[model samples]
Target chain A: MTVVIGFEGSANKIGIGIIRDGEVLSNPRRTYITPPGEGFQPSDTARHHRSVILTVLKEALEQAGLKSSDIDCVAYTKGPGMGAPLVTVALVARTVAQLWGKPLVGVNHCIGHIEMGRLITKANNPTVLYVSGGNTQVIAYSERRYRIFGETIDIAVGNCLDRFARVIKISNDPSPGYNIEQMAKKGSQYVELPYTVKGMDVSFSGILSYIEEAANKMLGSRQCTAEDLCFSLQETVFAMLVEITERAMAHCSSQEVLIVGGVGCNLRLQEMMGVMCKERGAKLFATDERFCIDNGAMIAQAGWEMFRSGQVTELEDSWITQRYRTDEVEVTWRD
Target chain B: MTVLKRLGRRRLPIANKMAVPENDDQASKLEFSLDVPFPSARQAAVALGSLSPDREPRRGGVHKRLTLTGSVLNVKWRADEARVLRVSVNSFLDHLSLVLETMHAFSADVCEDPHVVLGHQPPSAT
Candidate 1:
């Protein structure tokens, strides 16, 4: 039984997971929310990583009833993230690897999500829709590569949500997306917003601006409730995404749809995708929080696969690449 | 993939640790300072073009100037106290490359007598 410890310090969430063979022994997560007026501060994220990484790692080990020495290898997110956050996680992983004398593997955060979705859903050829704070893409596996069928031309979907949340003074409690989802549940009227889809790419900036304007007008009139606006926004955006995903699935001729990334946990978006998939007689796979959002287990899972294929990064070979593309890396085990 | 290799090369340290002598002719000849923050690139060009009233090497050449027509941020570098290095793009690609190169060279002290290449636009005939 090979025990692998994974460290995830991407986005605002810090997650640690312990896996043995193909089973997840323990997966615990902690979210670092910026105080009410302050947005994502790099220094604050770094400090949080330094403080919580150890606790989460220890918790994972303790819950799994395994000693530090019991771990066979270690995995951590290498890049496609904020530099300070990635550096902090790298430092912790490097320290742990040095102390434990275990092989350290650096995993791509995006691919980790895709692989984890595969692990949970057992989908062989699923068209993936990965939407998160930093990324938005429709992916399909082909020729041993995950090709991007569609993606955001400008800002990410989750970034748009977070920015809108801030604009409306919504407390980013639990999570910004979750709060928006809750507010959307109570919303009634659907205010028309710009739905801009160019070719396979989508643009959210215009829609964001339009919503702010509409919200301001509503505020001036003192008529529509904020919940209704939130609901309308989610409906419009999710419908746009579902429309694109449906197009991609038709183009790819695939019967399975897997939604991964932080925004995948949004029930409304999942429901929209679910309806589309059902209409097309296609299967939709959504990961739970442990694997849905950023976490270490997925990194370890991908690392183990990479390790078996003899893909390893040298110590000097490691560096944080903020714009690392998901389709750039070669995956050997995909058919 | 070739683009990635070119990007990697551009990211490498430009020079090793060797400070530009204070009195060096070239060092004294060039003027370096941070560019002004503009609400957008088009607005900045309009501002700068109005202020200078002379043909200057538009930032990042015609392509970038065209690309950053409405960009929110841009970096302007002046070399040889004459040419303006307009490093602006719709995306962060060129800006990131320039910043990384500058930091690496500055740290290594090898960026003293740097040669600035103006992209796509020729120097204005004064």
Candidate 2:
């Protein structure tokens, strides 16, 4: 079996991981945290990756109890992320491959998450719910491709939640989403928020706009608790996601739903998805923070699959992209 | 060829057009280049890595590439107008500044070599 080490810095999180066969040996990650009322900036995020990448790599190697020469190949997140952060990680990965005389494989960020979830949870051909700060899509495997049945036409769901957290000036230490999820549990009232799902696609900007207005009113007259708004936002957005995912499942005739991404770690989203899955007589597959949140082991796992399939990126052709799509990659490992 | 005046006394040739446009219908093709040197070849590679997302096609018909040869980082920009080339170059320089500053700020924390040239140094005349 081939041993691969992966680097992932698609956004604020910089991760380094090692994988052997289908087993992830080590996954170490660091996230860039901004002050209250501020969202992540690409430049700052890129800088964070550049500064901490090596330290993270060392930690991963130590955790895996492997030397640099033990690795057979290097893999890195190639795209579908913020441009600067993606490049910063790719550079280190490329340099490491060159230094260690190993093969390099550039991986799609979204596909990495999907494949790792499948591997860890042993889900086969499930309808996938991939959600993160920069992406929201309901995908299913068809004809050797992860075809997108639905996605956000505007901002992603995580972006909506993050921005809402910012509007309310929440601490971004652990994560805005986690804090919001906690607040949502304490909420008893349901505030009406706009829910927009167009055909198979979803839109979150309108909901964000409505919440921003509500937040303004909250700031003006102190009429509502932020917990109530968080509750309403989570309930509304998760419902829309479930609705589109259910539609995609019906379209694909798939009975399993897989949630994989940063937002997948939220227990409330999982409960809502689990309820929906039970109602439809389907199964739900999900992963924890180790496999979900932009980690390198996912890239390593995906890269191992690509390597086994004889996909090696030549040094000259190892280019990074900002808009690499999930469907653009040929899923050679899957039938 | 439309040659914009040099910036700085080093006379570092920035951009030059091939056959200046005679009219609005005829587009001028200009290529500009800036070579940045880091304290180490690895740092140059880091700078090149931070530009991975630039593989996507840019608007206004501007083309750019960032490559590293040893400790030198090379950035090339091609556009139809001197204005477009300037804008692209300026934007890239701003990003490079941020990347370099970050490298400087966090280099000690990451790199074992304290003397590594992670900070922004002035471009040389060579």
Candidate 3:
């Protein structure tokens, strides 16, 4: 019975998760919400993370009802995130590992999502669609690696939605993306938008730019409502995601499709992917808001897999990297 | 002498260095020091090892060096401007605070002088 504690502050959210084998004893998180018309900056996000990281860690421990001695491994998101926020969490993880005298496992953020999804949904082998504010990729495992079959050529799908959210000046109380998703529910009109899907790769920047201009011209002119704009944007971007995901499913010839990331909580995206899965005689696996959004539990789950496979990060190699790729980590834990 | 209870942050602008603008128009000539206290020399060295890596986002504009003096972790920084110095120092403080708190929380288990901390200096560095 291996117990692991993981830290995640790679983005706007800072979370701590404690896992004992396949069971999550506790997972607590805090998100920094920015005002409307503004996005979170690296420094400000790190400050927010620093302020509550310890409290969250304490809460995680209390919730899990576990002491420091119970934990066998310390895990943290190592990369593929903002530099400042990534370092903020990695620093704490390193210090804690030293104090607790446990082995440190530096986890890749995307792999954390995939591993967590697998654990929660019990999807033995599935093609993964990883879409978050920071990344968008369709991945499949082959020969000891979660190879990237397709990815964003420009901006991520969630970034496109978030930038459009700012254009609309929507509330970021919970999240700009969540607000947009709610607004899209009320939208009836489907204003035409650009659809850019090149082969297996997808691009969202051009679509975002076009919609930004269209929203400005149309919103002030009383032609397009914010809801309609949101609906149009979601339909376009999610359609692009479904297209590439389905293509990856075909390429991998897999029977299951798993959606993992902050944006994976979107019902519309899941519904769309579900339809594709149904048509292809495939099963769709996705988690709710609790698991879909960035959390320390995901990192811990990924680290648990690696640690059980006899992998641990040395103190000298625990520094965070902003651009670590998904395919960089060898999936030693997998068959 | 009263030892600092918490890590103290101090920034000094080198007027002489600023008078010449060492490298091009913007040379990070500002410097700051952060002295973080730990329960043991071993823990102080652990903090140094944990933070020594990780290069700054912008090279040449900012530089950081971590050294250990017994039970205190001494961090020195050099930067091109007050803004640059503030950014780097702010980040360092965040890391240092976490280290101190974690050490304090787990104080019961850590043994004294268990491992040799790599970056150790004489008390003169203080």
- Backbone clash numbers for all candidates listed: 4, 2, 3
- DockQ for every model comes to 0.02, 0.11, 0.49
Higher-scoring candidate on TM-score, 1 or 3:
3
Maximum-lDDT candidate: 3
lDDT of 2: 0.82
- lDDT, residue A253, candidate 3: 87
* Cα lDDT computed for each candidate against the true fold: 0.70, 0.82, 0.85
Report the lDDT tens digits of candidate 3 across residue range B10-69: 212111222324565555266677666654577677778678767777564888888877
- Candidate number with the higher DockQ (1 or 3): 3
Q: What is the TM-score of chain A alone in each candidate?
A: 0.96, 0.98, 0.99
Residue A123 lDDT in model 3? 96
Instruction: Evaluate residue B91 in candidate 2 and report its C-alpha lDDT on the 0 to 100 scale.
Output: 55
In terms of lDDT, the poorest run of 10 residues in model 2 chain A is: A92-101
lDDT of 3 at A224: 76
Ranking 2 against 3 by DockQ, winner: 3
The DockQ-derived docking category for candidate 2 is incorrect
Candidate 1 per-residue C-alpha lDDT over A268-304 given as tens digits, one digit per residue, 9 for 90 to 100: 9999999999999999999876688888888888877
What DockQ score does model 1 reach against the true complex? 0.02
Clashing pairs in 1: A187-A228, B17-B108, B59-B86, B60-B86
